[model samples]
Target: MLLADPNNPTGTAVDLDALEQFAQALSPECLLILDQAYCDFADGERAGRGLGLAQRLPNVVVLRTFSKAYALAGMRIGWCAADPEILASLEAVALPFTLTALAQAAALAALDQEAALFAQVQTTVAQRRRVRQELLAMNFEVPPSEANFLWLPLGAGRLVSPSGARGPGSACAA
Candidate 1:
């Protein structure tokens, strides 16, 4: 099974204890793919736990991307953590030259400037809170976000487009 923690769109993170239970329940034959693309934005306890779990569980694979926090989307660099044999299996099918030389340098440089990079993440988090509050004040229902984005679920009869067109049902189906 594959899951994105601090999930995309909604930005909700599963509790660590619950995740552990889920991992423990999975059969050895079952591969659990945990995507930690937004893990850097999550709080301390939640971040890197999947990697730790992957280190311990042969069936677990934790994937993370440098796109978001490292500001390296253009580089298209990503990485994964899993048992050595699992990684070897993945490496067997790997594409050639997928990671550019410049991307590696940038990612390394970003690592060197961790404090500055994380400060930017914190700024984004603060802005997210402020925007969520403003949206809530305007009567839009905004879910609490741990990721960089916010998810707003419009209710019935409350969906309106920027052009003032009314949306149908409980969603703004354009």
Candidate 2:
């Protein structure tokens, strides 16, 4: 099973306690992958839960990326945490030297500036809340979010393309 903690579009997250229970209930043979791509924008405890679960549960694997908070999307660098046995098996079949020297250096640099990056994340979270509040005041049904984007449910409403190319049922240009 694969699940994104802070799900896209909606930005809703499963409760950590509930997630732990669900993981415990699953069959031993079932492998659960928790994608925490946007976790840095979420609350600290919530963001770190996946890694804790991965460390404690043999069947759980947590995947994280530097693309969002670290602004390394172009570098395409990400990582996963799982049991040592599972990691060994993955390493056996994985391509060797997939990470370039430059990417490694960039990732290291990002790590070196972790405090500043996380401060930016906090700022973004505040902005997300402010934007959500504004949308709610405008009568848009914006649900509470823990990620970087807001999800406005426009039922039966026309969609607008980002490039201003109108498709069927589009309302306006970008």
Candidate 3:
């Protein structure tokens, strides 16, 4: 089973308790992959919950990326946390030297600047909240979001042209 903790588009995050319940309910043969790419934008405790689960549960693997909060998208670097045995099996089949030397160096440097990077994350979270609030006030049907972006469900509605004209057959058709 694969789940994004802070799901894309909607940005809703599953709490730790619910995640724990999911891990417990799954069969031992089933591997649960938690994609926490936007975790840094989420609440502090919730951010680390997937890693904790990966450490405690053999069948759980938590995947994180440097692309979003760390601002390292071009480097294409990410990591997975899972049982040692599972990691070893993955390492065995993995192609050698997939990461460029420069990318490795950048990832190391990013780790060294964790405090500043996470402070930026706080700024982003605040902005996300502000944007969501504004969208809500406009009656855009915005859902609660913990990630950097907001999802606006414009069901049956057509986007207005730059000239403020709604096309024929649009929901705004007169």
- Write model 3 residue lDDT over 45-115, tens digit each, in one string: 88767888887889999999999998999999999999999999999999999999999999999999988
The local distance difference test score of each candidate is 0.86, 0.88, 0.88
Clashing pairs in 1: none
RMSD of each: 4.5, 4.0, 5.3
lDDT score, candidate 3: 0.88
Candidate 1 lDDT at 58 equals 90
lDDT of 2 by residue, 101-134 (tens): 8888899999999789979998999999999889
Tell me the deviation in Å of residue 19 in model 1. 0.8
Candidate number of the best TM-score: 2
Which residue ranges in model 1 land beyond 4 Å of their true spot? Answer: 155-174
Q: Please give, for residues 1-174, the per-residue lDDT of candidate 1 as tens digits.
A: 999998997898998989988998999989999988988877668877898889788999999999999888999888898999988988999888888799999888888998898799889888888999999999898888778889888644546766677646434555
Model 3: residues with Cα > 4 Å off, grouped in runs? 156-174
User: Please, what is the TM-score per model?
Assistant: 0.84, 0.88, 0.87
